[model samples]
Target chain A: MDFAAIIGNLDLYLQGLWVTVQLVALALVIGLALAVPLALAASARRVWVNFLPHAFIYCFRGTPLLVQIYLIYYGLGQFAAVRESFLWPVLSEAYWCALISFALNTAAYTGEIIRGAMAQTPAGEIEAARACGMSPAMTYRRVILPSAFRRALPAYGNEVIFMLHGSALAGIITIVDLFGAARIVNSRHFVPFESYITAGFFYLCMTFLIVWAFKFIERHWHAHLKPLRG
Target chain B: MHKLIITAFTAVLLAGGAAQAKEWTKIRIGVEGAYPPFSSMTEDGELQGFDIDIAHALCAQINAECTLVPQDWDGIIPALLARKYDAIIASMSITEERKKKVNFTNKYYQTPARFARRKGSGIEVSAADLKGRKVGVQRATIHDGFLTEVFGDEVEVVRYGSQDEAYLDAVSGRLDLLMADSVALMDGFLNTEQGGDWEFVGPPYTDVKYFGEGAGIAVRKRDNDLREQLNAAIDAIRANGVYRQINEKYFDFDIYGN
Candidate 1:
């Protein structure tokens, strides 16, 4: 580890850190928005409706994100029609392509977590809502969702961290994220181990912060379960 | 309804499987996509520039089915040895370090190495000037080996994964000087801001002692017949002006220095 090289390239490294944070933040927000409805649809009684989201979740989760990124970015570009389409503008940049892939991947995992939590929602509480003449939509919105969010917090936290780490793949496609900057530095400096290690240290710090935040959220959600001393 | 849907889905799956098995028969040609003007993917998702066109032409000339497999530059040789591809057409320089591991066809394209510093930075280095400066060169390359031999330990050599990144950092002011093939450096300078700011310093240095004998298509060591076939095709192309046509299209002039 050349401490001097790390110190010398500190500004570039910091810029890379900010890009990574942006990638994760944007991906998580979009992923969560897509996941909740998919989770609800997957648990639906209709076979056709549930099958659509189930297959979506399975396909995204099964393949490596690297392959997905390439397919979306390079493979899609091969079609001239795609280049002429409305999506061409949005898909033209590496950042948006990576963002779309990461968001879709996180949605799949987060959906599964949410589905599992929904399945565990106490049937008796739903039954009580029905007796009170509450509409199905009201019952889910006022009761079921809050409980499922609490139940899904820990697993969802893991998904958040995975999405954050997976954002590193953006570097391969030329997005100037932390790993991308490290790769550039390593190429210039010829110290792969040192450059990558510095990037990893920053990622570790970010991961630790994420973990700390999620733990606090978990504690807050579980506070109701704590027994009061008589 | 469910039964019909299941039956239709099954038929579609079978048809898709059969189609994939028959379409675009596999012929793997390895490439280092990190090298632009060769096979790098642009930010907008195009696997284009030069080597791609050349590979397509070669496949058509040989009447062989093919696919271009993108591999990292460092592992390209090892991957070929492991039977990962039928041939390597990356902008790989034919060097002694690589020749020990793989055989080369006759030179496909050749460009000499040149030095660059930020334009007007007044940082000029003659062959004698690199005695004790930190120099950046792409790793596992003839250029890096040449610098090591010429400057000895007086030069601090840094190896990069690709020429593009090396030039990028040099442009960003991370390195004092960068060394790469004239063609690659030219591509960088023409396509990038860093290239605009960095001027090529000194005359290009060539020959095996410097830039090696030029770039060639790398085949397995044991594939003597394939090598002969490739060499013959390259010779035919050169004689018929096909090589010149392709070369002229992408480069400003013929880079296969005499």
Candidate 2:
């Protein structure tokens, strides 16, 4: 019942929360940007166009994100060439290494989610776009992408929460995210329950907010499917 | 500080060992099979190393049939308190902070902390020189606290889950410098081919406030009888040359800090 640990280490937790927010927010945004093109290529008819994206998704989704983070953070620096390369500056920092791995890992998962949504795009809707003189690029940009994004929204929300949880791994690489803060507290005070319970509570609060926000977005997006009000 | 008091009281409940004097036999020892040259798992799950040999020797000296229980480093203490094992021989330090929760036998071995870096890196241990440098240390260890207390934010502290992970970062150039037990660094990294270009930097840090009195066998706080038996066995072995035999099996030098 020594919940006072949370109050005493409040500043440390806040600093950790700030880092977690930055890492997850930046990773999700970058992942969303990469996923769009990845899904498009993955869904293409030509094997050459789809091959690279398919492989990228499989490699990432197939392996654990923790291993991917380890490889990027600790693996990349082992190479003499990597150290000599211009990218060394970014690769040398744990923050950047964590960010890069998280971005890439999320992109693979998000790409598959969007690709599944796109595959279900009605043939009639696509035909209507084509009949209206919409070019293929224009059709994807204006209709296909928009429709797929709305359909993928719920799944993407889940991915966002998963990313939030996954960012805890940043602590292993030395980035003091929320989990890291709790770990520090636990190690220092030897109060594993109090420290971790505080962290779990924070995460629970965040997950709830994300769910509520997503529910609002779904309501607005599914307005057309709702019963008409007199 | 308040949490420290709370931890002190709760430690009583966690390690609630029966205060009765019991005959010592068939004891289970907690060992972390992850630290190399001390205790590590072979490809086939057989455990071997200095700590393993020492544990065996101690058991023989005390005439106790012992079983080695493999445990992760992070949870070793909690596991000990939970009565999962009667004692820990995992190269755990005898420190004031740890004294709050567990009792320790006399130190079986001692080593000082040292920093290592690129051969020509020219990194000094001073706060001014270490400013902005990334120093890697195993998280939740004595070295981590020492580094933070010494330099505060002057150095960018990178704490890894294990000492091995820190060495990997040291090899990858992600860390400008590294810190750990001198013996551990020699065994875990300096002896490896990847460590060819790395050299020990800075003087050995032996502040009792941080490094403590060195590695000791830990038992539940109320297990006074077992602690006495372990201490006598340690003394007996050290006098009978059994300690040296085990020490030389792994190290060419005195590992007991004699």
Candidate 3:
């Protein structure tokens, strides 16, 4: 009923928007870095090479993201050893704890996505690279990884959005992300509908931006597969 | 087949239970079992504390059989409004905002707000000392409202969804300070084993504008007769020395602030 409350408190939402963007961006970048190695091991032929990544992926992806966040944020803090550790400074802060959870969670999901894409890479293409005297690692580096990445992009986009949505949970541990801003607004103003609808609108806007960016990248990468114009 | 039949039988029982009885012989009082000294559940699953004892004493005075329904702090008010219980014996502060939805009996008990921190933390209560310090408070509480209205962005105020969560963070050294009802701080945290290192600091915040007229029993606005009965019972207990017995069981000083 009161759209004015949202407009008046736009600064709070915008500040929270910046916090959300920073969290998601950092998590996605770090997650991708971790995911590459994880996917490589997961796609490996040796049982030992794949075992850890398999377990990590299952452990993260099988459980709820909220529980994972709590385990790191509150559960780890429960131990006196963790509290006294050098990492306590960073671990004690909600921002870093949330960052670590989001990154690891996204890495597990993204690792699986890339592993699936790597498996779907054409055997003929890998065979051609090997026949050209490329080493196994070079074949993977040159042909498999590049094609698999292109294949993984769309699914990776979904992971990015999922990570963004997961950032909402950061507020529980006291990081005021976008949804946290809505909660603060609601608590202060007692206007749930107006507060949440504004937050929803902001999320919708960001979702559109992510979709557009991914679409542009997809078109650019898939250009070679397009039929010749002239 | 047995499971389906049992489910139908339970549904019929629940439907029958939903209809309110005209007689006030049996009453349900909602309470938050998490708050210690006021109302907390023992390991044996029995509710005990000042609030529970007072509820029992009041029920005796009115000749009604009362049941204490354990509810979470956040849902306590909404559940009272939903007719899930006849009254909330929870330590609910009577504020103008809540007065719209539910009628509150005369104050059963009142306590001032206080700041608590780790012993020898050496922080004073002034805004200058607390600048950039992380102060933990329960979300949507009078203390939280006070912090926001007074401190605003001057200090880093961390609001949690529960007092237990805030206490956890406090024990972990994540919070520089905590604010809550003085009695809550004493029994819920300070007197507990986990809070051995914590101590109350600064003067008590007894601002009525924010803290309101203290904790009172909350009933539905339509329950005027119930509300009046509760008011009379509160007075009767205070008059007949029953209130003192309950107070002495938990607190040393008078919680019924002048």
Candidate 4:
């Protein structure tokens, strides 16, 4: 393997890394924003309230991300109604289609993660909040959400990494993320090992950064829960 | 019991008949149904194109029944290697790199690579002229290789999974230019309404170092006999004017380059 081939195209690799970061960051923010409401609705007491969110979760989570992206990017474009619609401007672009698919896909998984953590909220904490005469909204805001998020952090961090990896599929729709960059280099240079090994290293570094960041956040938020250390 | 015994005897006779001899009576040929002029799907879900016609002609000459298998371009070769199909009639150029993995027959047709841009774009198709411009091409193709090799440092080469996607980007003005097989560009894009505003720019590039020998049917390396049969069939079709009939159905000029 010629390591110099990889080193020579460092700029292209970095550009790919940047695209991957942008895609993951934007998709994660959108997904998390959607997941909070989705998880809350999915956990609602009323069957009617939970039905749609449950269906949404099942539909998005059950399907492959590649299919979802293709549906958004290609299938939608096939219809005249979609082309003539007001949202055609946003729906037509590959970047937005990829972003929308990634966001919806991660939302289903993240919603489940948050819902699981919320289910584990201690009974004593809820009783204490009720005893203080806190409103249902205030009780959830001050006590439940904070605690649930802290507990959900570790699982959510894994979702973040998965989303980052899944962002590689954006290349299929013509977005030049890290994987796309590696493909371009590989096709051009005809050196699969050098090109992909470089991309793998970049992905590894990103994964480590995500893990480290999550560890720091866990330390800060779960400080009281930590056992005393020497 | 008498009926069961009769059924068993008949089944044994049928099995013996089926085991008598095995010959190349049927062949499955892979094609990328997305590449237009060469191969594409009609609105009625039928595969129709020059490549499909050529496959039919070749199969007829070889006296074998042909089954066209629709495959994505990226996985077409690997699928052939895995025996998903007996041969690939896809417009895959014969290259040394690909030859290392799969064997190819003699050229069925050859075409040069060219760049297309929106009509009246006033952009020159030179390395210095395209510096920092975004050019779209299908990923993992000879055109992609040529662009990257020639202008990797000078231009931004955006890769797509399919030529159709690159054409879409070019139509939407996301790409300043698109590079692909000249005949494919003509039949798949430039001649269509979506590409009405686009025109071919720059000279046709046929550097053997990159574009390879020509488009050929690919088979597994072990299937040399099949490869030879395909080459003979290709020659038979060309000599008998069947190749010209299919060629005229798609292009005005001969795509079988010198």
The TM-score of the first chain in every model comes to 0.97, 0.97, 0.98, 0.96
Give fnat for candidate 4.
0.33
The lDDT of model 2 is 0.89
**Tens digits of per-residue lDDT for model 1, A1-230:** 46676788899899999999999999999999999999999999999999999999999999999999988866786676887788977786667999999999999999999999999999999999999999999998988889999999989989988888899999876576898888756644545577889999999999999999998988899999889869
lDDT (Cα, tens digit) per residue for candidate 4, span B226-249: 788888889998999999998888
| TM-score to true structure, per model | 0.56, 0.91, 0.87, 0.76
For each candidate, the DockQ is 0.03, 0.62, 0.35, 0.23
Calculate the i-RMS of every candidate, to one decimal place.
10.1, 1.5, 2.5, 4.1
lDDT of each: 0.79, 0.89, 0.89, 0.86
Chain B TM-score for the candidates in order: 0.83, 0.89, 0.88, 0.89
Cα error, residue B88 of model 2, in Å, equals 1.3
Of 2 and 4, the candidate ranking higher by DockQ: 2
Candidate 2 per-residue C-alpha lDDT over A1-230 given as tens digits, one digit per residue, 9 for 90 to 100: 57776788899999999899899999999999999999999999999999999999999999999999989877788789999999999998889999999999999999999999999899999999999999999999988988998999999999999999999999877888999999887776667778888889888888999999999999999888799999
Candidate 2 residue spans exceeding 4 A from truth? B1-20, B43-45
- When 1 and 4 are scored with TM-score, the better candidate is 4
**Top-TM-score structure, candidate number:** 2
Top-DockQ candidate index: 2
**Backbone atom clashes (below 3 Å) for every candidate:** 2, 1, 0, 0
